[model samples]
Target: MRCLENRVPPPLLMVIIGLAMAPAITPQLPYAAPWQWLLCALLVLAGGVVVSLALRAFVQHKTTVNPLQPARATSLVSSGIFARSRNPMYLAMVCFLTAWAVLGGWQWQWLGPMLFAAYIQRFQIAPEERAMLQLFGRDYQEYTAAVPRWWRWRTK
Candidate 1:
């Protein structure tokens, strides 16, 4: 159980789940070519920016970005993309999935992002938060109190 917490990297899990959900995403709606491409491109660019900002913050702080090694983190980043979402890296992945779903015109593919979020929240973010609590104590507590796990635009 706990041993499986950080075993599978989130990106890998998302890919596996997305593939499994592919069949359901078929019979996709026909959408305007330009509009679909525009939406997909926007999502991918947003995701790239979000992920890059998160990675830059981690590098700046000299913290480990490896999800499998939260204990190796040397600092807690609560700025930049992190301020908007406690798990910006995960959010970036969700954004990419959203783009995929949209491009495929598969309403069922929308489930990929939702499922990814749920899985990360349960198995990845939860354990990482616990480790952060242990490592940073009050600072991490304050951060959790302030920043929502997914996005600040959403309710706590």
Candidate 2:
């Protein structure tokens, strides 16, 4: 997170910039069906919003938001949506970013989200895991061992 904070652009900021660059980012001729486009947009926004809300609540109630310089955690949270994905936030971002790239209508914009994933993984996700492992030890390990890094079908 320290690396993410100091070396990388905020995810939100990068998303906004990519959106604003749509004129340049988009394909010159997007021939996709209007309904299909709408569906894609909705799916992305819905996924992003849902994940964002979950993360916000988790940060507020279960953990600290300042991953860069984390304040001590009050508890080890492994219930709720977290039981499914060890990185729901990342999953959500991927959905949102995919929709965003589709909105751009150009193959080039796909790299934006991919880069975001790479950055988050390397800078935030990896470091945060190290910290959590150190902080919670075996309990954290158990939780992560059960919940996958990304996809999950079981609700409970």
Best TM-score goes to which candidate? 1
**Candidate 1 lowest-lDDT run of ten:** 23-32
Pick out the ten consecutive residues of candidate 2 with the lowest summed lDDT: 1-10
What ranges in model 1 sit over 4 Å off?
21-32, 153-156
Q: Which candidate is the best by lDDT?
A: 1
The 0-to-1 C-alpha lDDT of every candidate, in the order given, reads: 0.85, 0.69
lDDT of 2 by residue, 67-147 (tens): 454326556667676777777776777777767676656677778678767777787677778778888899999988898
Residues 1-156, candidate 1, lDDT per residue (tens digit)? Answer: 687798889889878876776665544535437887799799999999999999999999989999988988899999888888899999989988887788676566778889888889888999999999999999999998899887887444
lDDT of model 1 at position 47: 92
Please state every model's RMSD to the true fold in angstroms. 2.8, 3.4
Query: Cα miss at 65, model 2 (Å)?
Result: 2.5
